[model samples]
Target chain A: MLLPSRFSRMLEVVSAMIMDLLGIPPQVLFGQLLIGLINGAFYALLSLGLAVIFGMMNVINFTHGAQYMLGAFVTWMLLAYLGIGYWAALVLAPIVVGLFGIVIERTMLKRLYHLDHLYGLLLTFGIALIVEGMFRYWYGVSGQRYAIPAELTGGYLLSFMFLPTYRAWVLVVSIVVCFGTWYAIERTRLGAYLRAATENPTLVRAFGINVPLMITLTYGFGVALAGIAGVLAAPIYQLTPLMGQNLIIVVFAVVVIGGMGSILGAIITGYALGLLEGLTKVFYPEAANIVIFVVMAVVLLIRPAGLFGREK
Target chain B: MPDAAGSATATAPAPAPGPRPVALAVQDLNAYYGDSHVLHGVDFSVHEGEVVTLLGRNGVGKTTTLRSIMGIVPRRAGSVRFQGDELIRLPSDHIARRGIAYCPEERGIFASLNVLENLLLPPVVRPGGMSLEQIYQLFPHLAERRRTQGTRLSGGEQQMLAIGRILRTGARFLLLDEPTEGLAPVIIDMIGKSIRTLKGLGFTMLLVEQNFRFAQTVADRHVVMEDGRVVDTIDNADLDRRMEDIKAYLGV
Candidate 1:
């Protein structure tokens, strides 16, 4: 978090600049922008996970939102039942979700590869429903409070607003995770195998790489990204079984607009769209939700493959 | 003509051999692609340092036989012994790691990876594999395009890159399928020269090809397959005598 007094002065200059240039109240503009950035952070994380899985396996994991929810719930459960705190849960929750994802890949998702991609989509959609339904059955629709850890409870006072520490942390960590995953996939030897497998799995196998295991792990890694997003979101959003239900559709939009095949595309699209949504809320509150979809439609008309997607 | 009902036929016509040192031996191999059985009890062998080519018409299961050996195609029943190691039960990767490598018919180069990256992607499978510099020296054009992605290279360059990529895996046994399928005659000669170079280096190879002129340039012996069975083996020394028979078997 920004250290109060000195940080407030710098923020004041920034907010003043934004206000002088845009003719809007600095407070309202900064607040909305910050909210948009936080939302973008989550969107980037979720869509990145989906893109990675799709890149390697060509499976659109419909269960990603549920997996994200599981991350939050798993965090809550660990804290409530096992007395495990945020620090430990941060490390454990993603691993738990990733392993669960691997299990899903082996028992359910792997069987769908020989058929059409539609089958994998349908199967993951089914799994998402099952997982969300099970959670709702047990927890009910009402949300529960997940307290911000003591270390991250408060916010730093800026000139125009208060910036919450946890939100800031989430933004930093999300950026790190997205870039880290990108680096691992694009720069490493194992990444070459993954990319090659994505292109021609049969040939990769002939080259002596274990393509199946790599696919399984790619799916798992993608889910783990969702898990991390959920953990970061738990304290920010109410811990409810229905948390992931609505968010997934927006994430799908993010993926489609970004290019499901391009890692960097997804991250940038997520943030840019979020900012546009935020700006729309300030200018025309009624159109806030629809602006992203509008842009997506325009992009599709102009470039059917998406901003970064290659021709099939 | 492959004699029907003859299960195990040795067409080696060895000069002095009881059982010459075998580098790769396939016995009664059967394979399937979904419900269609491609190879029906196929048998072939490559002794140490031998450049044995499988020549036949299209869809005769010569490619299937190479794939089956590498475990890319599922072998229903067979014994594929590579350097005395049973390979039927192993996966393609395991088979590849055990001193054997494949240069597929289509030259499976990853479009996204640069030439150097593709060269380095497969692990130095053992100690004797060629180094990046050695591969570059062999295919100097690839050296100029080391930073270029695999897809952008021309057809001949891609073929050269594909062949050079496997040479570094330290695999002693190389399975080359149609290495000169669509190349110009000059390029074909270069490939033939490389094959001869590899042969002189003592690498055991099983080549699947249709170009008799090209195959004759690199192979020590040519095994002709008809309808998924080895019909006859012609020694290179006997090529002039058996030209008509080889043509009749190949039906070219």
Candidate 2:
């Protein structure tokens, strides 16, 4: 949202200093940094959903990637068949996919509650494969383009780099969504119910809260967050059935590094790791893809519960 | 041992004068945890506007009885009539909405929530529940520590919070499991005073306790259980006469 003219002079000096220090061209450094932040936004959004689901439901949601893919596909479908724009699809996709998540939770997930955690994992994993397979069959493996909205189609030229309005919009929206969700779960009365239920569901139910219904709704909301990320990502990445599957493995690493079931941890780690990956891409291109996994391994060895997660 | 069942009608005092209607009645209550049978035909009743205690040794189904009444137990088969509503088939939340509240033995305070949040956690089902101001007035210490995380409070404060949580739920019937367990003597006295205050407010309570002495102070009747069945019922007024018998049943 920033005006390029007002910040260009300040950007000139800062860009010059960073370029000199890093011994790199100004465009390459700032371009990679902006790309890193955009990627970070997605990581933050996806991992936040994973953490919330795991926190409340005690289920490691392997279907999150598939859900993310569904969000993007739904958005594309809305645009292709119904002439819906990106803005409208952005609002509608999450709701559509969230309802889908509710169906999954009520029909399949609820039955596995009394069983072992492994059973839930296996069930969700199986569902993810089926969902991804079905989508791939319908859409084919080839990538489809989703045009950026007209309002956010252009870029702002700065002294350091050209910033896309859509990337800035994505970054701002996800951050707001992430923190807004955190506030809702951690500060509100309904959040109190959720936290209490997370601790002891039987006791919360005895207090007259319908916990099973809450679980269903919670799963829906978490999947809906992934839907938001997917819609935001549609214009940036090619819309492919395997898009969520590819990003989900990385998101899982982020969740682990941030700590399972820790909301703030997921967010902070997602962004930090994204920036770190961007830096790796700049300095050592060979390590860019594996940097996040290396961090996850280190975090696991040092703290199994995650950096922010409380020890049980 | 003296024959309690055979001599019950011969030695038992007549129902107390001006007996109120039964608030809760459990008949032929049977409960199981997985494959293990915990309660075998357990039966008890608490009259309205009275405090009753279930007294037994460890693992003797006192807690199980309370849980079964609350419908928190995994499998229970019995007729638990509350205000003429059959509760054995209702879910725990439904049972709670029917004005039954349970304060678990562990206090069930959330570590992530502050004291006020814990107190306000239970939804008020009826119209007459205590307000936050009234609950804070009852436990001034809780008011002082309102913003403190629930688990950070002392054992006594946590117990008070648990009780206060239910009090705000407007549920007239309370099932308190070992409220004074592991508390200091002073805290126990404070809890006893709170119980008396709750009773004065006309709240019916079914307390499960191993401490018979504490039960004697707050309860109108003590239903003694052994091997998951009620072995004897001692009125608080006649507790002194049957202290040795009650002690023998409690095995303490």
Candidate 3:
């Protein structure tokens, strides 16, 4: 009996190796692709926020990751402590984070407005450390799992793959959020003012636009977008302190590849890069992790300002 | 030349019967840039529909005066009044909404945005100021480059776009700094024509120019500034007689 069990274990190992050598099953491959698409959605949202803040205000916003983590934590706390549902948390989290951004802008960012862009990056980095440290003190480094809402607990079966309802919802929500922001800044009247102010604040103010107020609002809106992405991510990933920290580097890579020319570029680059990463995982598992950075390096070498970047 | 003088006199219509309104006045204005007092007790004014020019050599605080009036520079102590309304304490946008517009030395155009986009920008503030057709009529070259990016335009085209942008804001008072600073002679002539056209439309102007020829052609009165202080005010009628003093003061 012991010999037969050992043989069965060896057979199991050999089958796994064979499966690795051969192409992954279509079902498993598509499953990984779907996961990659979801990740792409998050990357698109986060990078779009970064682009907006950096393009208009010339602020790098290092605290964006901390704000994203705070969004998840806020949503988790709302559900666990206050008995708020997922829908309510989704609406409330962004408002809370946006208000927090307003405070930061008024108190700290206002002081650094006249300084160089590097100072804004450093100050925000410090703020990130302070916020993360405080959250770690309260919640500790261990992660907590958030329950999937009752409405999104099931899955739908496709031809070869099963798509979870919650995952599908994440994709839809992120797309809406991303496109909505792009339209607001690209196609509207207010967008013209924001772009003009970004180019020249003094001249914009002379046109009767309160540019300082616009700056504050733009920063707040960008931060709020990150918060919304965080809430969407809470159910998929383990709710932890370091969740946003790991993701932000990849989003930055996305921004560098896209070159903050227009909002559409950021979104498209993010999603396409994500899909490419998914394909990489299928063909060569080991290179999957570094694929985005590799793409970024190539983009830098080809077009330093990025695909849509303007030459100075 | 009576037609020219008559047109110039007709350019500055008298203030309507009211409570002796001061159209645009700056009194005892002081400004600083990181402890260097650039504007020291500067004083000046412009009446309704008057074409006033601010003349000074480089670094004599001519641009600073325009900035202070537009609230771009930090004012330490001064009052900027327009039609008896206090403008010093208000923010730049509020001051602009009160009908003051500024064109800086750099010709701040949204380089990435196209010419039409730049023209469409200020109209959001005053939707009825001027239509695209009107802007096209004012600067035909801008009409030709309507879809071209602002950065792609030549210097003359950029100046036209800058002036056209402000005009679209429905601003009656224009503070233009060195509009003809660096341009081809033909471009200068084009700009001069536009200025004359704008003057015909009865717009008030506070122009800063280094080109005395351009000023002589456009200005109704000239205020000479030296080291942030108004040295003299000369009407266009006395301009030829004071050429010696003007040359002595300006070193031109």
iRMSD of all candidate structures:
1.1, 0.5, 1.6
Whichever of 1 and 3 has more lDDT, that candidate is 1
Candidates 1 and 2 compared: the better one by TM-score is 2
Q: Write the per-residue lDDT of candidate 3 for residues A41-96, one digit (tens) a residue.
A: 98898888889999888898888898899889899999889999889999999889
Question: Each model's TM-score, in the order given?
Answer: 0.93, 0.96, 0.87
Off by over 4 Å in 3: A1-22, A260-262, A297-304, B1-21, B123-128, B131-133
Which candidate comes out best when scored by lDDT? 2
Which pairs of residues have clashing backbones in candidate 3? none
Which residue pairs collide in model 1, if any? B129-B170
How do the residues B70-168 of candidate 1 rate in per-residue lDDT, one tens digit apiece? 888854578899889899988888888887889999998898899988888776678967767767767778999988999899889999999999988
> Which sections of candidate 2 miss by over 4 Å?
A1-7, B1-17
Models sorted by DockQ, best on top: 2, 1, 3
10 residues in a row with least lDDT, candidate 1 chain B: B1-10
lDDT over C-alpha atoms for residue A282 of model 1: 80
Candidate 2 residues A1-312, lDDT tens each? Answer: 455675777878887898789888889977887888888999999999999999998898899999999999999999999999888998999999999999999999999988888888898899999999998898899989999989998988766788889999999998999999999999999999999899999999999999999999999999999999999989889789999989999999999999999999999988888888888889998999999999899989999988998888
